[model samples]
Target: MVLLTLWLTWAAASADTTKFDVQPFKINLGSEIPRLHALVNNTRLPSKALYGVGQDKGIELDFLAELRREWLEVFDWEAQEAELNRFTQYTAEIEGLTVHFVHEKSADPDAIPLILLHGWPGSFQEFAPIIKPLTTPTENVSFTVVVPSLPGFVFSSPPPRANWTVDDTARIFNVLMTEVLGYKTYALHGTDWGSVVGYSMYGSFNTTVRAAHFVFLPFFGPTPEEIAADNITLSDVEKVAENKGNLFVSLGLAYRDEQTQKPNDIGLALYDNPVGQLAWIGSKMKLWSDPRAGTPPSVLNTTAILTSVSLYALTSSFLTSVWIYASNPNGFSTTYSQAPTDAPMLFSQFEYNIIFYPEEYVKQTTKNLVSYKVHDFGGHFPGLDNPPALIEDIREIAAVFVR
Candidate 1:
């Protein structure tokens, strides 16, 4: 009886350990692409805006209509899928959920291990522009880039419980890096909701998450009184950035309320509706991006926009992805303790990101801030808006913080 029990215990242990094994994945949304085309073909766009085709009123009807034309007549999913597959992709079961990620290892024997995180309406694809450059830099520095889809975002499974928070997602990501991949330490860069998780990881897994770079933060910026108390100086450019930020807070966050209060409504409404998804996500792709995105050097083109929506629609993850807002009510208005903690932190402040947190305010959140970069260009999605600039900022951070 003792011998039989020992054999059964070993078998059970083997099965449990194998469950978290990473498996190769490719973005083959084959038949789903056809269904998407049909949905776009049949979608009826809303009537032109009363104010005409302009962003001041919502997504311009003319712009969205052109996008619709492009989606049905010009966009190519297989081409985009091929581009995404150029790098290695994989999925692993972690904490009872299947996690999808892009893992690109550098040839450099001493390459730094790094994980890139994405936020709402964005996926692992957001880091596509920087993945190859980071993993295979011309200079001596290189990284093993690991970009994971946030829970319920693209190919990753949704949060198993409605009460799930970014803190929970942070815990699983730590497992991805330290436990599954067997990395003693790693670094991270995040934007949008990714920054929220990145902050959590930096605080909770400091021994393993050695450093972080963020383009956005979950904390509110300093108020006028706080700025006066600090006697901080602001440049003319900083003044303009602050004004734009005010415009965003005053006029731009109604979507936040809807998503946080009634995620199910918008999620279900746009879940299978390709055009609806396009209009919803495509508008933000343009609005939140730099005004100069269509010019040379910018990667925020119509095809990129379409590919983002395709990832959400093809995977049928729109509903689950929006649950993030409802799951964490205090996401944006977090009150950090004055006491700074965690590994050295780095920041990249883009000119057009909706909110502007001055270096003074950012420093309050962490004790060991190593760098803060201010860019004249780029917006919320800096990886797409300005890849070279973002890459440089990250590399500089790694040189200082990563061993």
Candidate 2:
């Protein structure tokens, strides 16, 4: 019986060890440009429009119309594709699916291996600004950055099966880092859905995932009793964040709910309609970001938002991407586990994020909670909203692993 158990364990580990091919990839959007242009130009807006307070009533027609014009005229897919190609991009077959990623190695011999995970409505482009900086040797630390597109988003192929969850992504990414890339152990940093995937990896592969940093936690949030027990004190900013979080849960989660319950319905509706895709994704980009950071107030750059939308529209991945919610219907609702993780964990609390959890709340969910930080600026998309601050925070997190 003991021998059989040992044999099964060895076989499972060996299955994970199956080495796969990694091939260089480049982004090409030339053929899709004409179709994208037609879609943008043909989009019609309501002649009589009513505006509400800050995305409460959905994306304003004027804002989306302006974005549509820019998508047709100003945004250059060729230039963006060229920029993307500057970094080393590759795709590897893992579990019969193609996983696309950006692998930027540092010149510093002692640089740490770091895997960055991005969430929905986001691709590896989130880390574009920080990648070079992270790879450059700083006085404190440097990292060989590996940013992977989530399965079914952007360049990566769609999920092979219908029920692909973040947990499955976690396992495949672990294989990419350890078995494919030859990293014995690596550190992880993630935001939004990326946090869920990174958390799974941290829990499931503790020996290989040395430490982790997250801007989002799992479903286990602090209850009122736990909050009272901790005797937690909140600053005025934190109080506002809490209110915003409450508002988001009450009013702002319709998109999440739709995706979780009936992804295919909206997915099929928006699959070929770039205008629909824009309204669906662009609203979140505008509402979830820091208003002061970009042009057009609270929204991201027109080109950036268009680029993101174009990726989905061009690739026909809107359906597959939304399916993540379906696969993990209880992800945001169910507590993954109460048992603390052995890996060192760090978290960042951004004021404008959709969900806000106090440090006390985070502590209850983590075992070796090394550091908890509160940022005055930045929101859900920190990589775009506040890259410098996010980069610095990641550096601080990386220091824990190096030491």
What lDDT score goes with residue 213 in model 1? Answer: 91
TM-score of 1: 0.92
lDDT of each: 0.83, 0.81
Can you write out model 2's per-residue Cα lDDT over 1-403, one digit (the tens) per residue? 8678556434432323236777888888789899888877887877747644456778988888888878877888999888878999889999988999998988765577899999988988877878999999898588888999999998888888988888899999998888877777789998888988998898888888988988887664554455568788888777766766777777888899899989989999999999999999999888887666573222347777888888899989999999989998877753435424577888888778878889866776677889888887778888877787788888886657842
Give stretches of model 2 more than 4 Å off: 1-19, 50-54, 220-230, 295-299, 334-340
Task: Show model 1 residue runs off by greater than 4 Å.
Answer: 1-19, 224-229, 338-342
Residue pairs clashing in model 2 are: 291-298
- lDDT of candidate 1 over 8-45, digit per residue (tens): 43342233236597888998897787778888899887
